[model samples]
Target: MYTSDPTPTSTLLDAAQTAARLPYPLLVSELALVLADPAVQVPPRLVQPLPGGARLLIMPALDANTAITKLITFTPANAARGLATIHGDVVVFDVATGQRKLILDGPTVTARRTAAVSLLAAQRLAPNTRGPLLIVGAGVQGKAHLDAFAEGLSIKEVVIASRSAASAHALVTHAQSLGLQARVVTNADEALAGCPLVVTCTPASGVVLSTLPRSDAFIAAVGAFTPQMVELGPELCRYVADNGTLVVDTVDAEHEAGDLLQAGLDVTRLASLADVIRADAFVVNGPVLFKSCGWAGWDLAAARTALAVLPH
Candidate 1:
């Protein structure tokens, strides 16, 4: 029923403005519904390797009325050049007429949805104890997660850990500007100890941290989407698998998450994010692990919310 001669394009700033208008809880709830709805269709993502070890990923999802596709490129070598490692765009379409609806900045969509999803998991998995928050990697995802959690949760103290001390200090300064008590730590173990909530947002191919989190801590790893990259080590995975809940955004995560794949976790035992959202008796007994490899349905849901709030 909708058609346009030229599709409207939304910049990353526009997407951020729209995100600011939509409450975090609403965004998470919408994504949960899309994940639980039997009518929604999300096919497996397609991957293609490019020259110089870069890779292109295509993810498509459709509900009864709308459809969206996200095209992403991962170039690890770009980091050395002071560029973003991942970049892409999302295309939204009207299913009824097969007409283009909106095109959104992919990195912005990814950062917001990823953090929102992690917050949803943290709300469900994090213990009731009040402790310092630890964020590893001071990149876009790191900053996004900090903002998302700060908006919804009662975080009193924040600790930032990054390979670069300057980056960590800068993030701490940013957090302080937002009225958050924050500090920087060079040691991963020192940062992980006694933290009630932890989120890792790095693209490290090997284990980023070897320290074990507190028994009641909830950790969210948002990096290492491919089979060759990992942020959490095998010991951490085994600890959660043995003593706590291990949840992922989608069942397909077993194939995409390098941490889980390398950890040799039993895919059949992992629970989906939708399951956690829908379950009424869910409880975490110890440290909890929530791994997200990104999903097209989340991008579609975010774009839809943005479109509804954007001014005409």
Candidate 2:
């Protein structure tokens, strides 16, 4: 029974406040329901190249009562110039009534949902995870992950690593400012050395962390969604398929995941987080990895959470 206004109502601060209030377990359960619900259909993203270090990605999600469309633009050029790398808006419409209910700030929504996705995945996938938590990439996603994860788990140590040592140092400073045990590391090897759970938020187009020093750890690769971007190499996929569980947001998306596809990896058993959450898990004796290409269901879940917390 909602109608679209002449002007969209949601703002960044509004979304942020809502995001902060949405409990981690609630977000996780909502995402699980969205994925497992047969009425929801979220297809693979359709991406388009753009000019000046920008790319356009379109994502669509469907449920029994609603349809969501998101158009996102990534412009590293803009980011370098102190602009948001991602900028866009989200449209939510009632499937039954065909009434557009709301339009929201896409960047804030994306950041919150994506971080929530990572934390949820880590909660389900990683075990005995006391840290020395290592985070690769200190970009927006990386920062968001740290912020969200801190809200959900107890962290004793945090190692921030990036290609730019300065960026790593900055993140270390930020973490310390928040009273976290944190420091900067050099590269993947150093970051993965003793960390029990590592999250990569880099936007590398090729393999960033291929193989780890040991199999006693956990990883959540949060970057890379296209047919050419991957934060880890094929070794990680092979390891996951052989010794651990490899749950993806979607199978079709992983098939197009540049690292796995290029490495001739056949990820035949791609289970959604919903499936994993609902099913009984097997005991694992080695490192477990979860890869995410980002999913539209997460956006809808985050949007709903934002709506619940924003002032009416």
Candidate 3:
């Protein structure tokens, strides 16, 4: 029997540092490769509802030699207590021996990998776009996306929109601290007006945008995973269906993304991120929508990347 010592643990800060060391393009390419492999297994995520509207999520992925599982919890009410809504850990193991290798901070890996994948789609679908990037939501994903874009893409300015003015302003301050020009917008419509790239990371149960986005924009909606919650409305879906293809991280999106479910989108017509990367072309010459509901394969990829950079 194969045996191993106890696994090393990495914190959120360590995960962030490790993720930062890797280039966005490389991360995107790695994800594309993983998704394209026929041998890689990404089963549907398991969900268990807890009391008080909280839920636990179990996501697992496996390749030939590596396996990983992420255990996360979503507590919407945590925000009232000034805590993060999502929290958990990712466990990585050796597939051949079933030996645990490493444990990583789940939220950090999720944020970084999610943002990186979004940027990947944006790069391919809207390569010529120059910002003024618009980011909706002032939470963890919001800040992480800001940092990713700042480091990976060229942008002249940034606009942040949130339900609360204080949250938006605080994110603006955070952006300035990073030496990026950013400001707060009063509403989503104002923020989406002329921005070439838009990212939504809120947790609103209903449609968050009050107005239609520009026809030439590339929108990345990362919030609203469950079928009952949505960030984008039917109008946006219709627009994309009419002009450009609606892109998703995986085929599982049809079952997990509330934005797509609420819009009654045709899953048969939606394009996967792997297909986009492989084709290296946009499905249309108009606005594109990329909706991601978190994938376990991403957690696996991120864990491998983080472990490579961490000291032994």
Candidate 4:
């Protein structure tokens, strides 16, 4: 059977082009559908250690009609070298004919999809949707999350904090460019109580969020994926588990989620993003903490959406 192809020549989309194809709203829609699809298969990601404290990641996922693999290298030291920390490409293929269909910039897909996942969790779990959103970490993921919340949630105000003044102000400028009232704070913890919707995207080796959020707060901790890295304080994580709902993006998080793992949380007992979405009746009691570990299924879903936006 001939497969319908979106990129006959395997057209390669750069960062900007790929970002253009997968807007937050479209990516969120696709994520909700793909996450609930029983036919989708996401294999565990392979993390191989490279020399000099670098890592090579191999992620693959597929569905009835499409297949994708994202190969990327992660080096924490890249920051010291004044270079990007993550770099790679997402290659898309057709299932029926086993032919290459398209290629997308890997880092773009990673940043956008990661932020989109957090946005999805916020949409379902956040107690307050209106007012100022607090964002920690002023990197690529921080920018992507800002755009997602601003565009998808129609959030009109933002407060940003980062280790670097230049980076934080730059993100503040970006937020205002989107017509959102934006400012910078010196401390994320100090800014937490005022903003009920919060996203932590730092790559901290220790707990970045120690303060307990307000009862109406919704927190998406997307910073630390490895057991060696953690962004949520142990006490705060335990508080959420006892007093509120603790959610994860995928089951893989049980082993990979540094925030929950370091927080001494029972990762296996917590509900997931899919679980909340499928629940017939859901109610929020206290703060909601959504921990996200990387998953290839998200990349596969993003590939489908990115391809659909491409001309046949």
Candidate 5:
């Protein structure tokens, strides 16, 4: 019997390219399939802190022959030092033989996959939008979303709102350097009213944005994975449930999201990514909201995709 060649390792740039070229609809399709497939199991938070406030998150996903295992570690100090806040590596292992095939840096993959998930949500939830997209956080995830959106959507203007005005302005300059129209906003409401699509990428105990544009607006809250953390208000959860369709990354994690549970948002009522994709069309009888805690299935989808593309 001949053993297969070793799995090939790739870089974050490889992941970013995969994210950029992969059609948005197809990513959502993969998400739907991954959600329905019983072989997939996403474990709860596996975070461990090392020296110097550095942290590690073990994210594992098993989808039949494809098993994507990731070890993510980072430090805010590292980020301040012009390094990565989230860095480490991902290993694609063949479950049949438990053979580690490929390894890639976690920071790039993390940022790319996170942005891909956001784009999937945006395509499905946000309507035919134009101009002034508001990004709540200016960190890695926030910047990744801005970069991905600039490539995928027709966003003419971008307004980044962060707790630090300087950081927000730096992101604006960075985005402009990338040749996209951008600015910084210190006021949340002003940014929301100016932009129809609002993406919250920060971690806050309370809502960062309230009183969104009452029109056909879309909000995608990508931060706040823990029960103690949330970026949107309890009212926003009600807004999505009452006015628009609420899409969750996983129904299982909904109970953990404080924004949803505190507001008494019915998890059963919310649709899954599969539900959204398999459906023929989206009927927005009301406002739409997507609360994503970043499911492991997404990492699986991206990791699997990466493994398939990388040479072994």
Candidate 6:
């Protein structure tokens, strides 16, 4: 347990070290615990606008044993600047003593935990579990999802689509290196019919994917968390809300899920991940959309996973 060891250590883990500790399977398991625990407290994240459309995110969460605050910056234009779009640290604390325990690379934690959350949703709800995973937007989040589905879902093939050819090809190479059959496509919609499992992780305010591959297709929309940004087409969002199972990572999506809100969806009427897990139910014969707006509880789960694997 996180509280068993009381001593505090200010060990600061870099991105590589952080990623080394939080593997997909372990992260996914921890996320389940976080989602189910009634004591876990995640207040609405505070967002501060920055110059040039970037923003600062402040997310804090705590349970009985541990507390964490993830401070990160979202700079949408950074990719073209050849720098990371997200940069910051996750500061962890021991709840019993009120002392700082550890620090982790914020982007690593976010990417890994977010992808793990999507993978967990897929395992429970997606009809196409093992597949030619179609990933749109070959950025950090895209790569992380590919790794997560490959390792957690045992995916054998991947098809990637992105505006940047270099980024897309690089992700495909990474997929092949992981022993998955990988290819690049000019457009994601063109590949949709063949691949049932799709992930859209771009920072677009417009639609990247507007259609479903099949009746039981699973789409994880991880990008465009703000009200002004959307990755899924409005019609597609409405179709899922009306006919299929639409799940959000948390209720925060009611205010933050751009695609759904743009489609004029009453997000409050949609089920959440916790609701789905608690009810132990899913849409049996229709499509599924997992809308992930950022939540602090996921960061707390990542902190727990890292703490568990850290050397005692």
Candidate 1 lDDT, tens digit per residue, 156-229? 78899998787789899989988889999887677787687898998766688767777788889988788888
User: What are the per-residue Cα lDDT tens digits for candidate 2 across 199-218?
Assistant: 88886655678765356677
* Cα TM-score of candidate 1: 0.91
Ten-residue region with minimum lDDT total, candidate 5: 1-10
Task: Report the Cα lDDT for residue 145, model 3.
Answer: 89
Please report the candidate that would top TM-score against the real structure.
6
For model 6, name the residue pairs that clash. Answer: none
Candidate 6 residue spans exceeding 4 A from truth: none
* Model 5 accuracy (lDDT, Cα): 0.70
Model 4 scores worst on lDDT over the 10 consecutive residues at 1-10
lDDT (tens digit, per residue) of candidate 5 on 202-279: 745467887745566777787776566677877767876877767876775566566677677777667866677667
List, residue by residue over 162-254, the lDDT tens digit for candidate 3.
876888898899889888788888777867877978999987666777467677888899997888878987888777778765788888887
Q: lDDT values of the candidates?
A: 0.80, 0.71, 0.78, 0.87, 0.70, 0.89
TM-score of each: 0.91, 0.87, 0.91, 0.96, 0.82, 0.97
| Candidate 2 weakest ten by summed lDDT | 1-10
Task: Name the TM-score of candidate 5.
Answer: 0.82
Residue pairs with colliding backbones in model 2 are none
Model number with the top lDDT: 6
The positional error of residue 295 in candidate 6, measured at the CA in angstroms, is 0.3
Displacement of the residue 62 alpha carbon in candidate 5, Å: 1.7
lDDT by residue for model 6 (1-312), tens: 345367657889999999988988888989888888888999889999999999999999999999999999999989889899999999999888888988999999999999999999899889878788999999999999999999988679999999989999999999999999999999788898888799999987578998654777899999979899999998888887777888999999999999889989999988888877777455455888899998999999999999989653
Among all windows of ten consecutive residues in candidate 1, which has the lowest summed lDDT? Answer: 1-10
Model 1 misplaced stretches (Cα beyond 4 Å): 1-23
What order do you get sorting by TM-score, best first?
Answer: 6, 4, 1, 3, 2, 5
